[model samples]
Target: MSKLFNWYSGLGLATKQFIYLFIVTLFLVMVLAYRNLSEAEALLKNQVIRDAELLVGRTNQYIDASLDNVENMLLLLSTRYDLFEDGNEAIAADTLRKFADYNNSIAKTLYLVRTDGKVYANEQVNYDIIGNPMLPELYKLALENYGAINVSEPYYSTMSGHTLAYVLPVTDARRQLQGVVVAEVNLDSLTERIAPMIYQSYALMTRDGNIINRLDSRDKMLPYQAGAYPPVLQESFREQLEAVKIGVSRIEGNHHEMLAVVKSTTNRLGWSLAAFIEEDYFYQGLQQLNNNYRTASVVWMIILLLSAYLLSRSFTKPIRRFVEKMDRLHDVQIVAKLPVTRKDEIGRLTQSYNDMLERIQTLLHKTKSAEEQKKEYELKMLRSQIAPHFLYNTLACISSLAKQQRIDEVRDTIRSLVKLLAFSFDKQSEYVSIEEELEGLRMYMHIQQVRYGEQYTYELDVDPSLLQYRILKLTLQPLVENALFHGISPRNGGLITIKGKLEHGVIRLYVRDNGIGISRTEARKALHDQFEQERSKYRFTGIGLRNVHDRIRIHHGVPYGLRIGSTPGVGTVIRVGIPVLTENDERLGIMG
Candidate 1:
């Protein structure tokens, strides 16, 4: 079994699929053929039985009607008033002759025998029946019966070759026997009466098993022969025949097989009828049906083989294309997207593959760009390092020269400018103590004050308790510069103020300026312009404001950012919100 599995596994996918399909098709065909043949045989057998039962029922009705006709005739003869009362023998004879004349097909001859055993014909003339021993025996039997009707078994007579007799006794109202009336019926008349109702071969048999009369399929008579059939018959090629109310059995003759359906009258006649049909008549069509099934099976197998080949290709072709494309996937080579025409599992797989390739290519490009940018920034930092030290030295020389010349204001201004530039270049300390930030802002504002003189008077009213907390370096310096330039530069004497406080676990810082205050609309435009690449209408360094806003948000999240509010001809206030923290906070000394 393991070797067989290995062999099958070694075969190609299409070959395996075709083998499975072929096996399934063969099994289905065999099962269908078997079931169809079985059902056909069953249906044929049932139809034959039903047809046989129907024919037997019709034959029973015809035979029973004939028996009834004979019984009615006997009753009519027995009921004659003169025959029962022994009054007017001529009238009784006339009544019998008229009855025979009217029903010649049923009663061929009618006669009467007195209780004394004297026989008189329907002609009213007495015959010497004692001289004939056979006639005397019939009268003697009638006398013994006395009052009841009796029918004789089939017999041959010199007058009527083959005949059956009906003997009815005459009795008065007191049930006293008078005479016996006998009616001789010709068997040929029975055949003529039943001729039109028979469409198949039939035999009428007496209780003693003698075949009284036989009729062919055409209802024509065959020669009379004595053939006894018992209440039951055993045959080699047929089902057992028994004296049932109705029965059907098969019979194999010398040359052909036949199916026989039997029904017994079980009446005064002591007769039964059996109908026969040839067995080959039903099986001939079954042979033709088998040939048709064989032809159809061959044709269907051929079609299934062809269909299996095509269906197998439909499955394997797409998979082959996917494998080939995957084989060509490499770092330097770009694989083309597969075309998806169906919404099946294979189509989804193709789509997923294409998306995966695109993400891989995008990450590759981003990695290369990040590497290049890292190198450029490293080079710029090294090149810019020497200039800040040189500027510091120059500022120191100017400060020393001004102090010797007793120019205290110029000396202080140059020193303040040097401190601001040094602090701006301090990249190592991204966060500084709030006190340090305030000190730096004081220095920068002092330089602006020296330049602008009394035109810009600023106040710093920060909560003293918040002076030790850490804040982002250079955050407040840019906002202060914008207020001086964009708010105060346009007016002669403007006030700039800085206020800080701790509220609701947050630090609120506000920078306000009272000058030629911008309108609310203009303030909104200024804030929006800060985020743009270009400067605002006042040519202020909006980039500085945008930088401070972005740094605060990036470090503390969007919840804390710069907010601007102002009114026309009124002071403009810029507020900044940040989570309040003490010296022990984890983020106190961290770089922004």
Candidate 2:
């Protein structure tokens, strides 16, 4: 809104600059921090996934090796054909008991079952080989895969909490189907042998998703399903588990996210081994890294903000000083120059301002000198005019009148001459009111009219309101004299008109004469005082038209000066322009 813009504009320059710098820098810092954090997270997540995969893969290898070892042991024992011979039941039983006792960590029990319904075990027990619930499926599996070791899925056994049956069929010399030597493995013990030291949780499951054993419990025999284990191994990860034979995946858990790695055993068991860890737990270092990054970013932002503020202040400090100095510069008398302390734009501006002040002071001194000279010149011209033909003519007229006893006419003519001399010599001020200048002009014209009676006539037309306006002393008298001598005098007699008016803040004075006018080239040359050398012999006053023009320009500036309009054989009109300066107005200095 306009209000917000106005408010911002009203703020100090330094404050606004600070805001601009800080906002831009803050945006860039945030973007960089976000990018760095994202990259770190991606790298950390990848490391966690690789770690999970390595852990699960190693555990799977251990389980497969253990199963392979058990199978090899059973196959070695099957080579002992004497255990299945007609008279070697005691020996076979003793052999089986020793084997079970020696490898008790893996094998819980050993059984020797014959096709003839004879069943023997490591422990003394009476059992029907065909009727034992745990043995029948294993027996059929052994027979179908004859001469090769076979393993069954985990099953519950009363004696052992969870057990797997490894069976190897015994054959005769004729390759006849005899009985099977069975080993009941404690699944819990086997899983413990393959447990990894760094895993949070691990499980072994059958191809049909049956839970064989888990690290959390020794008696976990339920089918694998949701809620049976950690949520990492639940339905969210089940799809990935079935899709890949060995790989790692990220999945959502109950409260957080987790990484799960699943790998299937390479042996005949075809069991999958999986290990999982929470993302937060696995990448705890990454979390700490993120925290450190955030802390550093905050500190950097604070530093940047402070730096921006200081820089903005430093940049605007000089400008503010310049403005203050400018505000104090109310008059030429009190003007002060600013110091240049740097080579920047502000410093350059200061230098320029100082140069301007010097130029103004120089011009003021020159204008004052010129005004004094002009006043002195006017007085000199008036004193010199006393010895001229005008004085002779006036004296002769007085002498002629005295012989005729015209005493009143002689007194008036002498009084008018004295008044004219006194007005020109008055040194009261360089500038005088328009009315005073016009009064002086009237005195000068009265003397000329007395000498050239009936030869020329003069008229005055000036606005009353403009008479109070001030102008340079003796400014108009020279122009009127120039018209009288150059234009009117050449024709022996002519009518002269002096007009004054206020036009657009300027005081314009026109002196018109219906006399033999000079050419335009002569007018231009006369205004520049080029014709003064030729006309000096006949001119009454040394103050020429060009002196009037120069004085006006120096006081009022170039825009307000004299302009000439003339027509040969017709008339000449010279206009003088000057600004209306009242008593309260300061004398014009430099325009700027």
Candidate 3:
């Protein structure tokens, strides 16, 4: 059983078990009935077909054997032509008699004919056929196909009664053609030869579809015309004769249907023997098979019913034990635990249920701890925004005076430095407004201007409407520092542009500089290269570029981080795409 099956069984729902067992029982019953019927039908049909085909093959073999024998006889007799041609009456008569005696089984009466229309026989018959176009059809067949033996339609010979013959071209001792030799075959003997093939119900038939012999005949019976076969025999036997000339024809006798296997003869003989089997009798055995099948089905169903009853009884104890365990586990002070056993389908199921309960308890503890950590990070962001704005304004004016070579302005510059440092170190918090972050940037800009002494210029194009947008605490401070440090060069001290605007609820910021430009290759390397060997070998510092990139990744995620683009002798532009947030998003806060 899979874990799912065992798990369902262990469940406390009684209705679920009843549904599953009922469905399984109905399905197995239907399948058993369907399979048994289909298999039985195929077996019965295949047996009938095989029997019919086997008889057909036997018939084909018998016909081939007869054809072979008569051909050999024709070849041997065609050599004795001198006695007949020289008009040696005694020798010719004796030769014909001997030929008749030796091939008595197939030959009926020996006769001879010359091309000049003379017919002679060893003995005489009721009809005198001396000069009456004697055997004109035989002669015609011989003219068409000379030197080869032939089988002809049943006909009466003038000197010999009913007969068939094998005709060949006769040659003299000098090997000159003399006349033709006809070896007669008795028509009655054909039926006699096929007598043994006549089985119980069916009789042997000739090629013309006549009943030639019967299995129960006492004396040799002459072939007789079939008045009519039963409807079954006529239809079935005709079809078998037409299609599978070797097998039992579907023939009907009286009211019962019979399947007859028929064989055609060899030696070009026109006889066919067939055996019939009564289909009605064979089908009678099915009633007995059905009775046995019904008994077996009832017995099997009863056995399964008994097994189900025993299984329900055995399951009662395990059900009671499992319920008792659950009842104890429900008590306020009791703990639910499962006993361990070696891995097996049922044992593993019990262990899995216990493991799931432990996992749920651990998850609760982790959720509480994470909530605390979020508050701490939030406070850190607020601290970075709160400090450094107004104090730098005072220090900016004082530093300008001191730069004039006015020694008297020293005291004023010291006082402003004190105020700037105080605002720069304000209390820690998380989310801050953009206006607050901008205020800190203004202060930092003043300090840089005083240090650069008219060589650096800072331009801020921050939209006033977007000042209310919430931003992460130190988001803009690093970007300002980046523009001041790496963004400025000697020829152009620094012309840094800090622009911020809102587009579709997202804050868009940019820091552009008119400094010695970073190459496009350098910009790509700065973003991707981690190992020193992979970075640009050219002497260049990427401290501010690297820092701003890392800070954006840490705050927003890898995708919404800094985008750097530059050209070799042009300037570099750094862009930031960040989400505008609210104070509930404590990771982005304004100064309090």
Candidate number with greatest lDDT: 2
Could you list the CA RMSD of all candidates, in the order they appear?
Answer: 46.6, 47.9, 38.2
The predicted structure with the larger lDDT, 1 or 3, is: 1
Candidate 1 backbone collisions, by pair: 209-228, 209-229
lDDT of 2 at 364: 92
Model 3 deviation from the true structure expressed as Cα RMSD, one decimal place: 38.2
- Which run of 10 residues does model 3 get worst, by summed lDDT? 531-540
List per-prediction Cα lDDT, in the order shown: 0.67, 0.73, 0.58
**Candidate 2 Cα outliers beyond 4 Å, as residue runs:** 1-393, 533-540, 586-592
TM-score of each: 0.36, 0.39, 0.33
- lDDT, residue 538, candidate 1: 32
The number of the candidate with the highest TM-score is 2
Off by over 4 Å in 3: 1-400, 403-420, 527-555, 587-592
lDDT for each residue of candidate 3 in 516-577, tens digit (9 for 90 to 100): 66777777776563612222111112223454455455556656667878775567788887
The per-residue C-alpha lDDT of model 2 at residue 441 equals 78
